[model samples]
Target: MILRCNTGGTRTDNFAFFIYAFSSLFAIVSPVGGVITFVSLTSDMSLDEKNYLASKSVILACIIALFFAVTGQIILNFFGVSIDSLRVAGGILLFVVAFDMILAKVSRESVTEKEIDISMERSDIWIFPIALPLLTGPGTITTIIVLMGSAVSVLQRGEVIAAILLTFLITGVLFHFSRRIYKFLGYTGMLVFTRLMGLLLAAMAVNFITIGIWNIYLSFQ
Candidate 1:
């Protein structure tokens, strides 16, 4: 059976799927990223320092995304790593987050276990954990790089950036309504939803691990 490949349709479909997957992942992990940003900004930083740091972090996120877009494969190559392995690791992380969300245990260790020092309690909390890791942490950063590499066209940059911006905007609203959302959703609601997302994230992790191992095996053959 000679079936003609729908290159155009395939690319479009893939793009859409990638966008949603990435966006959902971002949304799921955003609360943590936001928290990180808020903490970093408000801790031991002046208003001007917070602003500068936030801007720097934002720029760094974009730069990291661009680097991954252009050299993600190269990065793997350099580290003798495979996308599958990366996926597996990422997937595991995602799954943990999802489980936490489902269970409603939204702790910092759900993502990174590093202890944060909130010494400068007088600083602007908005820019610290709120924007950085809470919004653009390792998971978010890795996802951006992977998606950037998946683009079928240079023009898709706009779409990808748009997707990121959209996610960020939504995240902003969530943060803006943090008190209210927490009040309404409550910990139980958050946990229920988080657990659901964890299952989805587990699927993603399996894919990464399977594909990564497969690729490694294939290379040997």
Candidate 2:
């Protein structure tokens, strides 16, 4: 009976963790925003060309995300920054991003108009705005680092990795069908979705800040 109860509890905890990670990552990545940029950048391209670019961009983004997920902790340790400090800083940054999303403003922290212009001039944008700032920007990187840093066990780490992979896979699908999705959702629907995500992100940011502060306080004892 005890073994069965423990197993059930573990499963529940893992499921909850997965949900939290997925929601946080999805909110940060903002596939709706990606779709808008993807469509704008590839407006003159054929459907096949757009699909190819989407696939390439998504694969590259996944690689970058995974690399950071694996090495983010080490990088932080080398820089002598504690996870708690990172959590507080990342939370503040996310709050700023959420504010921008709520107002339907494009975040200059993620990408700038000048970068977009440069990308427009490039023949291959998969590595430029599309994959870099558009898909895996600093916000996404910080989120991944914080998530990975908080993983205490191998199982928890696996769950975080799974969440990252699943989020990127969904992002790829959304980008691949950007035109169809835009037509279906239209502008108003996209704005509504972005704001909803922003609200969730704001709540998450608060949670992160609370946890970080609590951890820091505990360390003093």
- Candidate 1 regions exceeding 4 Å error are 1-15, 31-80, 107-124, 155-158
Where model 2 places Cα greater than 4 Å from the true spot, the runs are 1-9
- How far out, in Å, is residue 98 in model 1? 3.2
Across 1-221, the per-residue lDDT of candidate 1 in tens digits comes to: 33322443355565675576555546545543343334433445554665465555445444544555567768878998756567657656665655555455544532233423452453433334443455556666666655554455554544666666566555545544444555677656655555666566556655655765777688789
> Can you write out model 2's per-residue Cα lDDT over 1-221, one digit (the tens) per residue?
22222323466676778798889999999988778778888988999999999999999999999999999999999999999998999899899888988887777657776777777778879998888987798889999999988775677788889999999999988998899999999988888898888888889888888999999999999
lDDT, model 1: 0.54
| Candidate 2 weakest lDDT stretch, 10 residues | 1-10
- Residue pairs with backbone overlap in model 2: none
- Model 1: weakest 10-residue lDDT segment is 110-119
lDDT of each: 0.54, 0.86
- In the order shown, the candidates' Cα RMSDs to the true structure are 5.5, 2.1
